[model samples]
Target: MGSAVSLRRFPSPEERPAALRVCRLPGVYAPQADTRLLVAQVRHEALWPGVRSLDLCTGTGIVAVAAALRGARATAVDVSRAAVAASRLNALLHGCRIRVLRGDLDGPVGRERFDLVTVNPPYVPSQDARAPSRGARRSWDAGRDGRLLLDRICVRAPGLLTPSGVLLLVQSSLSGVAATLDALGRGGLRTRVVERRTEPFGPVMSARAEWFAALGLIAPGAWTEELVVIRACRS
Candidate 1:
């Protein structure tokens, strides 16, 4: 494992592949640790020309662009129009031909299957039972237990994959890593945690620390969370 790459500013082309020049649009989820972690796993995959890939909840479409750079024909989907636009802009900026769609997780893709599916959805435990319809918070506010989207992805991902397809997903430990694995396993996919990273709480988590602690989601004074990348395969 290497040091986490900060997304405070877009990385220079010299720092990363030109295709990864992702822009952080307002109200769109920025590429952060989880995004980089998932992209790293994307680079490790055996991608080739015509390898179809899909990225769900693709905020800035960084993951889709990463797959495209590796010769995978990528499609990105997001419920937010801003996210769809950002994904398209980033793909165009990198000259990567990615199909960007505005829809809920895995919804726009319909019955279309792919060789690979990647996701970095909202997994933060929130007081609200329903996710926000708009604003930056919409990018990470998962309902109560934070499994709102994660659970749906687990159930839907298996059907989205090719016979030998793979799914790479990232989420925080607070969101129940074992539950995700179990859900994917129940869906008939073999799953494993391929990467684990401990990071300090960001603004959102920090703001809700007390409430999370009250709910016993974290230790009273704990201010950090583990991010894990789980890989599920249809082998």
Candidate 2:
């Protein structure tokens, strides 16, 4: 609600006074640091009427609901059926009208463009190489080097935007921040980091810390991870 946001430091999620209604599926993704940080950034935007916002990887529809709360028409997409159900329920509970769809990233919004697209896809370095087809791993498992879905999103998501539309994507710095910027930039969008934040390694990251450490992705004793929100816009 001010002027422009700062980029040279870790961005904190703007604290809200009242908690909103949220539901979660067991073993499914629940909103965490990345979620809160992304939500905070979305709130700072001037979401005027008719600004359509799409939330990709909307585990519980929290980000979409936040956009709707800020007066933007919102849509949420996810591949997990449980996630889709959870998102719909949360939207209803929050009194926000949201179209929740159950399908892979680009399928639900085929040929439909939005003014703003929000993404919080899996970026954690995981063990699985093949794409996760089900279970909780679907939310976190990315192929080695951790750019599996990130690459796909960077390539496909931009095409799903209206002219002058914006893409707000959140991922751990470990997934190659520069690569993301380059991918989007090469794809013809002006990109920049709008927000950043750090949190101690969550359980998933902690478990794989040793693997990544061996590969020199993380320090031997590193216990925290940095997250960045990249804002890409088409003019």
Candidate 3:
């Protein structure tokens, strides 16, 4: 086991006004730049009028609320009760009818399918054994190799999607974007990068260099972290 990584507490809606609130609250990990970028991409490229959508791991329900704002009936899910509560409150605050559920990825939505599914799961690859803070544990830790949640989501996505439905997911460059794409492909879904951003701070940047070094994917030095927006559909 390795030393525990310190994590930042998730911000609350009170900390930021609703009008300017772009991420979820009461969770350790706030929405990253990738999240906002992906939302914009989905809004511009994929969303259609009256489409039903699912937001997997919806933290503050920002994605679900955005989808509803765009005329997509939306449902948001998260494993943390606090997250579900925050999402529900946020939805109500926005006067949107987004449904909120508490369960692991895909557990809350169960068998029901949607025209679109979006996920912004924890993608940090760490060997830390210390129990993370509530928000960190649920929203930041991505297992020893960072693909734990991503793998599960991709494997189950095929069943949750409507025949022509698409999945939009965000992953960090530190997690090996190419490997993630390959994993999605093996799960029978084709992928493409719809968005990318380089950030210098946050929990992701902390162990990024070390992780990348061990993986031998990039040379040791200051490297930019990329947010990959992957679009996948049933073939």
Candidate 4:
């Protein structure tokens, strides 16, 4: 597999590939650095024509579509209606047969096993104890310390994978990479940091900088954060 690609910035419109372009309505999360970063790692996986793949928290369904294009039988799940619509729309636009479902994480898939599972779930720390149930903020806001979805995934992902399955997950450093490693380790999966990229604070992170520092989530006066893609496998 290729080494982790360092993230820089979102590509300009003209630079984006025509095949992967998507239509996003307001309240739906647009594909960003995290999405592209995850997609890059997805390309590195050994996906055969009929491999079963699942993408949780699929916003625009870009990751699922990518897997489908590679000939994997891909399924995507999301809780938000808008996100579900956007995911289905993108799948149709790409002419990929993706089973897009409207439900939270693995709940929608139920007892199904997959060879590969990918997720870019909400990981941003929010003062609110629970992520917003309704709004665009639902795409990125996790409860205090930002582990709400991350923690659940670490616990649940192992069960969702087949015996030899692999999982690719992306999240920010502010969300506690070590905690994730430990959780997945306890879950019996061998894990590694496959990719790491430092990105400047975006609007949300910028606005929460002071609060983050106060809560000791970030160093005082720090404005940059690292995003990491973690690969876990059940051998």
Candidate 5:
């Protein structure tokens, strides 16, 4: 896993493979740039067989499955029932022994500690002040500031990790990367943005670019957004 190889980036129709390995069900947030970035970082981690890995807001469980395939004991949690079901199906399809649970973030896995944790939760800032607890909106419609779930993860994940454990969280820079670093830093974790990738706006983000710009979330005509993967290791 030295000198990480960027996994297949899907930008153009011709660039993506005709047959996909990921089993994406409808309403389940499909793997995009953030997912690929996190997966790439996951591959580079010093993982061992039987090491415990947890995926928060696991979605299709691709990240958790990748950890299991790498010989770690992986567990994934999601708030959406469809996401949990899709995760289970995809894990089975990929022949990975991943435990898929339906719950919000780490709620279902009370007091469970892990060697590594991966988070790609809902981080998009939406007009709605209150984020939806159910339906497809829960996949990305975070609160006005977009740290609805990110804040919780920063507060809880540090305590959920083993002494030598590390957490890998991926979210858009618009959601406030500096805020994330500060929150995790307060938790006594050694944190830093391990990876940064600039990607063109997706449909959801593109639609909100104007709104974000109007609110000064971005510069006018800033059609692109940067995604970052933060690596926070326990001190």
Candidate 6:
């Protein structure tokens, strides 16, 4: 696409009120500072023109639109029906062709290999039913240890990639970044951080720590909020 634009903006935590701007989609989700960072990261990458691209957990299809704007044939997938609908609508709004599919990770795009795959999977660890935002519950929560979906993606990724394909994923250090790297390695993928940032912990993280303590899984002062974006390729 055009030169990548930086979406990262600093608003004081209190000033960073969640705003409702229409995404490239139907319904609304909280668009935070990190979302912009993600868009910029993808824009800076060397995307092969006219190559096929896949956006896992496509949500509002922002990433897919970016890919299409860059001339790649993009497909976006999400487990939530609303997200799928939103993505399609957003693609239309952007005047870009981004195929939307409803299914987990690679489920809907069966046997379809792509030159690039991008995902912004949920990376929060929480057991509090109320901790997640409506969108976060569906798109952000990664179960108890926060590796639920990430683990699955790593295992399934190699099979989904073209011989030269790469995966770009965003995850929280609070969810254990090192462990995630290990998981990818076990799946025969080599990974490197493309971006790193510190954000405040959301409610889910507090709940996760409490639950962990209750179950003797950790001592106090062990968890904090930090996120990292990683680029992975088959080893």
lDDT agreement with native, every candidate: 0.88, 0.84, 0.72, 0.88, 0.86, 0.71
How well is each residue in 1-235 modelled by candidate 1, as lDDT tens digits? 2233223445432366443566666778878788888888998899889999999999998889989988999999999987888888888877889999988888888999999999999999998999898888899999999999999999999999999999999999999999999999999999999999999999999999999899988999999999999999977
Question: TM-score of predicted model 3?
Answer: 0.82
TM-scores, in order shown?
Answer: 0.93, 0.92, 0.82, 0.92, 0.91, 0.78
The positional error of residue 60 in candidate 2, measured at the CA in angstroms, is 0.4
Residue ranges of candidate 3 with Cα displaced over 4 Å: 1-24, 129-133, 207-218
Please report, as a residue range, the 10-residue window in candidate 3 with the lowest summed lDDT.
1-10
Q: lDDT of candidate 1?
A: 0.88
How well is each residue in 73-160 modelled by candidate 3, as lDDT tens digits? 8999888876787777667766779888888888877689998899998787667633244645658677666777877887888888
The candidate, 4 or 6, that scores higher on lDDT is 4
**Candidate 3 at 218: error in angstroms?**
4.4
Tally clashes: model 4: 0
User: Candidate 6 on 60-119: residue-level lDDT in tens?
Assistant: 777777778789899999877767777776677668898888887898988989888888
Q: Write down the RMSD of all candidates, one decimal each.
A: 4.8, 7.3, 5.9, 6.3, 6.3, 7.0
Model 3 steric clash pairs: 10-27, 10-28
- Model 2 misplaced regions, further than 4 Å: 1-12
Question: What's the CA error at residue 216 for candidate 4, in Å?
Answer: 1.9
Which lDDT value does model 3 have at 47? 72
On the 0 to 100 scale, the lDDT of residue 37 in model 5 is 85
